[model samples]
Target chain A: MAASNEFRTCSVTGLKVHLPAEALIKANAVVAVVFLAVGGLFGLLVALTRWQAVHILPAEWFYLLLTAHGADVLLFWVIFFEVALLYFASAILLNCRLATPWLAWVAFALMLAGAAIANVAVLQGESSVMFTSYVPMKAAPHFYVGLIVFAVGTLTAVGIFFGTLVIAREERTYQGSIPLVTFGALTAAIIAVFTLASGAIILIPTFLWSVGLITTIDPVMYKVIWWGMGHSSQQINVAAHVAVWYAIAAVVLGAKPISEKVSRTAFLMYILFLQLASAHHLLAEPGISSEWKVFNTSYALYLAVLGSMIHGMSVPGAIEAAQRKLGFNAGIFGWLRKAPWGNPAFSGMFISLVLFGFLGGISGVVLGTEQINLMMHNTLYVPGHFHATVVAGTTLAFMAFTYLAVPLVFRREIVLPTLAKWQPYLFGLGVAGISLFMMGAGTLGVARRHWDITFSDAPLTFEYPPAAILMMGLNGMSAVLAAIGGLAYVLVVVGSILFGKRLDAPDAERPRFIPRLPTTVAAYGSAGTLHVPGTIVLVTVFFMSFVLYYFVNWKYLSEIWPMR
Target chain B: MAITSPEKRVWWNEPLHRPEVIWITIAFLWGLLMFGMMVYWHVAGRQNLSNEAYKVFPEKFAEKVEDMVAKYKVREEGATKIPVVRPPPGSDVYVLSRLWEWWPILELEKGATYRLHLSSMDWQHGFSLQPVNINIQVHPGYDLVLSITPDKAGEYTIVCNEFCGIGHHQMIGKIHVVDKK
Candidate 1:
């Protein structure tokens, strides 16, 4: 039974914020940032080592750091932030108390402990088995145990989220259905459950095998089941980040989806078909039938891709519609030109949307094709594709949300506003460069996760094209630039939390977070006639690029030695 | 509106915008096209991954590779002692992947097709043929047999792209596709 005093009305957004939920969000977010810093540093080291010219770190440290980099960033940082998002979307948005605050704290403690244990195991030099672990290459037993513990903790937090949702419904916190962002969060949570379950199924057996209790862990079976968790976890990211895209549109521009049905249906498509895309990883592997590969990799005729395409249009369309209504109606591109590029939140979200669609979305579809995968499997292109999706798309979107959340959730004025304004572009451009260069190198047959692309110490020598080595050098430079941007983000966020002015204080001046619109402007269904011609043109360009790239990959495949 | 509940309770009944309808239709059709292309490629395309795989013991697979090497070893590759075996056209060729090397370098005549058998002795390895740019996942205990036709004559490098261990970068093999007379 939480007291009424435990809730405070936010000065901005006018949403009722639960104190416990806010604290939990803050704690989870801070820890997520901490992991991001550590992981980003490790990533920089890896990129430098991969650069043929620099070639820093011995072979042993390269693999070790690469493993740690993947774990800390992909698993710890992203999942921790998602847990915070789950809580935010449920309790705070619903204007209800978080279900079992004590239990939520316990979940957090377990996650912290799990993350620490995994890090320690990796640091102990016994668990350099990379993030996929791909059994038969046994890591420390504690590595598996730590991951299991982490997954259990995440599962507990998800339970609390669902419980809070129930409480919100029971208490009748608001009218009608849950908000679209919350619905999107629900989609992510559902996917998370599936992901965690798959992880438990594979990892538990692997843990036993690591301790010598089990023998003959089949490698093929490990990959099949492992990707069930591995790739599905990424699906969770897709759903969550799309939700953030929607949330940012609402907060920044007070924009509604052109049609709730259309948007919600797109999210529904993700839940139904996104997990099937995991088959792409196994497309080049044997022991899997071509029938299974074709069916699963296409996601039953690319319905999930259709879902992404929908978001690709609607997100920008929503923004365009909102801007048009605000009288930025000079031409098809006027609204975009007049957009709030100076605001980090708006700029970050917009950059994320565009780059994600162009670089990540297009490349992913091409790479996932069954035959096309033969050309790019285990290449630097794989990492290039993911950096675009996970880092540029999801992480940038999260950073944009943080710009809003710092003031709204943490109730602190952002420190170093000037640096914050430029952070997104700096980070976004650097990441885009990394993705492009890595893919370029991969196109030239540069192997990923190898210590030396030059193969300086190999018995039989092979030379990569000079262009591939050049791409690696550029990738290393981009990584350094991205690392600086990451550092700026950490400094701004931490500095604001510790030393910036408190918005909640009675004496403090509250800056208007959400700009006030005209009285006549309705919040929903106000974009009459939906004349988003700009977005239409944009998506058309995207379509053309996709068509070009998809066919180009097939052309590349055709040039390879004939195989069947 | 995304942050709050919908203004209408019956939100599903709302009409979709014309652009959304058009985009969805185009996107769905594009998806179908992509799917059709993959299926069509299987029927018409020359390059397709072979689904032929078998379960075998590591020791047994190693023995087969040794047999292939003994029967067809032309000469030792310069500097490295790895045997470069030239199997007959349309023969079953074996290449075993282990901790740090792809053993028994292969030689084939251009325009000659052969069933290439690949399996890892331990752990999983990626058989990434460079210059030609064909890659496949090789797993222990499972022999993946790909039908390979060297259409062009050149020296090809087999790069072990999968991270097997510390010596992964050093694990390289060669394939010589001699021109057909």
Candidate 2:
């Protein structure tokens, strides 16, 4: 792949690309899709199992599948995609060569090996201690070892991303600060460093304990430290997906951030306080002080929320401003109405932005509250919030980007154009149902990790409310819908890569399968008159939902414990 | 200068617009309010128990469980309910968690406060009380004291929400709150 440090600029987009870096980008992206498919399959089964009516897997298999599903989807699939994005942002956008091709390959190999080892451990039955793997309930030593190895690889990739940035700066790739999208990637990379380090700090000793090298490990201490990896890992996703949102807006709509400095400051806020969101996991756990929980849960007053709200507003606001510039400004939502609804990239991202903000972002703050967390933690509500963020938010956004990559990276036309257009809505709707129904069941007191909520086989049986059962059934139907949606995505992407017509370069008579957008947004005009009242209205809706949901949780908490 | 190019005009270096400034102010105010609420809840609401935890030995915990079990064996109906340890009003009560059961059903009086000490004998457990819908994580070798006053008197089931073992779902405890007789 590395004949030389040759360069080729994309004629359509006009960005100079280092040829060696392109190979890495393609490799990482392809691998990410593969993991997403596998992880998604596991997710479907776990959902079916949780359905209770289906009860697909028995207790042991259920736990085993849950572990694999969490690890693969949450960690492996997302990180793989993120690493590809990191390369795209730094090397491609900045028009610089990836710092070390050999090291990047090594990182990829480590990640592949680590993912394989961890999966093997879980399948072997000894490591069925779901993804959290709380200490004292030891998994096989290889489980921790595998995770450590994977983290090290991801950490190496992040380091390489930083190195690429340094090279871009040194070579004067562009004039001023890097693009806002690239800046967002930098935020993700920085957080990755912290997340991986925390994994190593906690997991290494746990690995030792598993192997009998250490006598004992405290479960509470393990939890407190583990979320530094677990929850912070999700934070990494938040940053990366938010970056993807910005990139999609630019690429699909020629939208610029309403104010680059404001957006960058938001990214800066992410670096400062986003990881503190991990404290939400420990809100109800013993061994942590109330002062610690309160301070961290509030995160110095939800500054992290401020960061997200900024991104939320800027992403759509810029799109609105740009659309108005193009004369789509017929009414408050004319720009929105006239948007490229057929382009899976725009539609998927827009849906992701809305669902993520209203469903995930709002519920997150509700769960982050010290008192209210008591009602939500360890319930299906926790997963409900995350599915919105990770699946509805990140995974959907990544799928949208995949549409862009199939053309640019793989040099193939997207297959089933009509199906491609509708894929996001179908899949997004399924995921949304899953999130909402699970949260409803959780609110009705459904256990997060229970094999069976019914407890049918136990000597003493307990039946949940009829509402809870009904909710799980609804969640099950949603899971099936989401699975079908996921299947459509995989078919379209893979079918496109394999059977679709190939594209010809620059000025030929034109190949059969040319991309809809010859080039992404490269030279769109500046952010025009900031008369985005439409965006203001949408954000207002978001704020109202957040306040209402938060207040409802407090009211529920009040009812639970009452007063002294 | 009629700037036609996007790259030529860097949005960051440019002056902030009215919309951006306005949204920033709103967001900052909201964030400040959330943090303020958190502090107020912690200080004033006396909500979210966290200052009441410390490490405890497993052996001493087991001995205490045995004592509580032998102290209050109450037989009712044909089926045998686990011993119900009736602690005095406003006093601390200890409940031991092991294998797949939370033992010594603690009966407390309504309208009076009681500190409930929870710890697991094996692995880790979750103190999930149904109906009330409150969850607190319980770890072995750690005493998590939940300071509570049950306003609604009845029999509440304490289910272990944390995934402990094969029978984690079956691990249930009963907390009966009666009137001050």
Best by TM-score: 1
| Candidate 2 lDDT tens digits, A128-237 | 89889997888998998899999989999999999998988787876666887788888999999889988999999999888888999888778878999898888889
Clashes of 1: 0
Residue A76 CA displacement from its true place in model 1, Å:
0.6
- Where does model 1 exceed 4 Å of error? A512-514, A523-528
Best by DockQ: 1
Name the best candidate (by lDDT). 1
Candidate DockQ scores, in order: 0.77, 0.47
lDDT of 1 by residue, B1-181 (tens): 7888998899887777778889999999999999999999999998999989999999999999999999999999756689999889999999899988889899999999999999988889989998878888999999999889999999999999998888888999988999875
Report the alpha-carbon TM-score of model 1 versus the true structure. 0.99
| B148 Cα displacement, candidate 1 (Å) | 0.6
Q: Tally clashes: model 2.
A: 0
lDDT of 1 by residue, A1-564 (tens): 579999999877678999999999999999999999999999999999988889898899999999999999999999999999999999998998999999999999989898999999998899998999987998999999999999999999999999999999998998999999999999999998989999999999999999999887888788878888999999999999999999988888777788899899999999999888779789988889988999899999999999999999999988888888788888889999998888788888999999899999998999899999999999999999999999999999999889888888989988898998889999999899999999898899899999987778898889999999999999999998888888888988899899878899766665434455553336334334668899999999999999999998998888888889
